[model samples]
Target: MTAARTEQAPGTRAPDAPENDVVLRLEDLVVEFPAGGGQTVHAVSGISLEVRRGETLGLVGESGCGKSTTGRAIMQLPRPTGGAVVFEGRDITKLSAAELRETRPKLQMIFQDPISSLNPRRRIPDIVGDPLVVWGRRDERAKVVPEVLTAVGLDPEQVADRRPHQFSGGQCQRVSIARALVLEPEVLICDEPVSALDVSVQAQILNLLEDMKARYGLTLVFIAHDLGVVRNISDRVAVMYLGKICELGETEELFDDPVHPYTRLLVSSIPSMETVTGADIEKADRGRGEMPSPVNPPSGCRFRTRCPLATERCAAEVPEMREVRPGRFAACHYPMLEPVGAGAAVEGA
Candidate 1:
């Protein structure tokens, strides 16, 4: 059975509740890829979450933790194997190809790879205006293309006729963002938008996205592996591990007071020059191990293999996400009451 959805604020709707303030809701969403020898890669396993309109919901996790897959699943790039993706009160997973194509304009995604997402042969104007052309707005391309290019901090006059290959990585990303914005999409899924850029360029792209969000009245799903970046832009953050969300809450709350062992470890692992000494490094190394293969993940809690708090119980049954604080939810039998460094209980204690 799917987990029960949690309630939101007065004006907002719960995942299972009637659609109101919520723009996107994932109900027991599952995505799996088939491997050879009849094996399956469990990409996303029963992740149910809600994204309210006008809010930036951050999805963070280590590589191979299904963050990107979750983002793709939301767009139905490849329809999920199980569960539902409800967008604006409609079940998109159930929509036919023709029906889904009609609904695609409102939901758009900015891919992780800046250079490859765009066609090298296509000129900037033609690339960014492709969406308009598809939607029978070729006549309006002259106006819309330039407007969006400028909105993304690119000079329309200079870049309009240029090919994507001529621009830098940062410039290409700006073009990609411009393409996504040309449609004035309501929900924008940014899949590691800044991961491939230099540290200096990352800030520029992030600031530009914030500005675009306000200008377009967008609701964003920002996916990244960097906790610092996620915390900076996300109103609420979801920490994913092995296809499931282990902890979720307000960004500040999750950063300052992480409840799950995995969440705590991730927060502590953030690089800091002042805190990179012997003791800090030692603490960071604790319970560290390679991520288990998704093809044959651990039995109960997928994170138990690397969790210091693992026990027979943790291996016996899967933990359901429950409210640990007012708006914070964690899927752990023994959620951390204090920071992980403050003598939190662990296995074999």
Candidate 2:
């Protein structure tokens, strides 16, 4: 179900965000598609978020939870069904096709399957330099393409003539990254860029991304199901469930003290040697059921079906995103670490 928005939401900027520093803001973003038979796949429900300049905002959630959809929506991949995507203070969602082409250079993306994303029929240089050619900057191809290739740790001299199939998966990802950086984008959206790589290669790619971020002054929207990876790179984290954000806060703050039951379950799911909290275990256990179909999502809170603390109010009224602490926000009528009052948990729930 789509959660209701409060005054704090749609206007809920990241805690560390300064009014003038937000590079991208999503206002009630929604993306849906026909599922046939008069049903619709609620890919991304009404959700609002802000990406601050020079900060990595990690979007973490389980598979099919809309993290990747949200990332693609920011790029206007299919043009969201609703809402505005404001980039650099202008609503690009309203921009004309030609206008969008002019604005696209400042925003780039690295896909999950690096090898598949790169065209096998094209040579490395052609693949990486294609952006320059497309944007009418072909004159700068020889200069900028090699520069980005070197920046991403690939020797243009060696790999430039080779095809995408010649390099390993990790190398192809580096190529994808180089292609994204070739245009010198101000914002980079990484859609699970490392999920298809080896554990060892994941670290290398992660390190490279951080290095690139610092060297190029790029804002990032890192979408992944791996909380460990998100914790290492993100300044702030937004936990999504179904199609909405359940919690958002500083990386460490949210990881250490998750407020939403869904967030707690995600943390508990991570393999840990340290003791897990009783509350976290309980939340995780309660959240064991299969996720409800997005086409016919549960009423009120989307997570209520699996949330053990759900009550009648949870079924009747949509939870609004609200600050449960100084800076942390959660969209649950009965947030964790708070006293359960009138919306107390239902018996045997």
Range of the 10 consecutive residues with the lowest summed lDDT in candidate 1: 4-13
- Which candidate wins on TM-score? 2
lDDT of 1 by residue, 151-203 (tens): 88888899857998899899999999999999889999999999999999999
Candidate 2 — number of clashing residue pairs? 0
RMSD of every prediction: 3.8, 4.2
| Model 2, span 130-179: residue lDDT tens | 98899788999989888989999999899867998999999999999999
Q: Which one wins on lDDT?
A: 2
Return model 2's CA RMSD, one decimal. 4.2
| Candidate 1 ranges with C-alpha deviation above 4 Å | 1-19, 274-285, 345-349
lDDT of 2 at 105: 94
User: How many residue pairs clash in each candidate at the backbone level?
Assistant: 0, 0
How much is 176 displaced in model 2, in angstroms?
0.1
Segments of candidate 2 deviating more than 4 angstroms: 1-11, 338-349
The local distance difference test score of each candidate is 0.85, 0.86
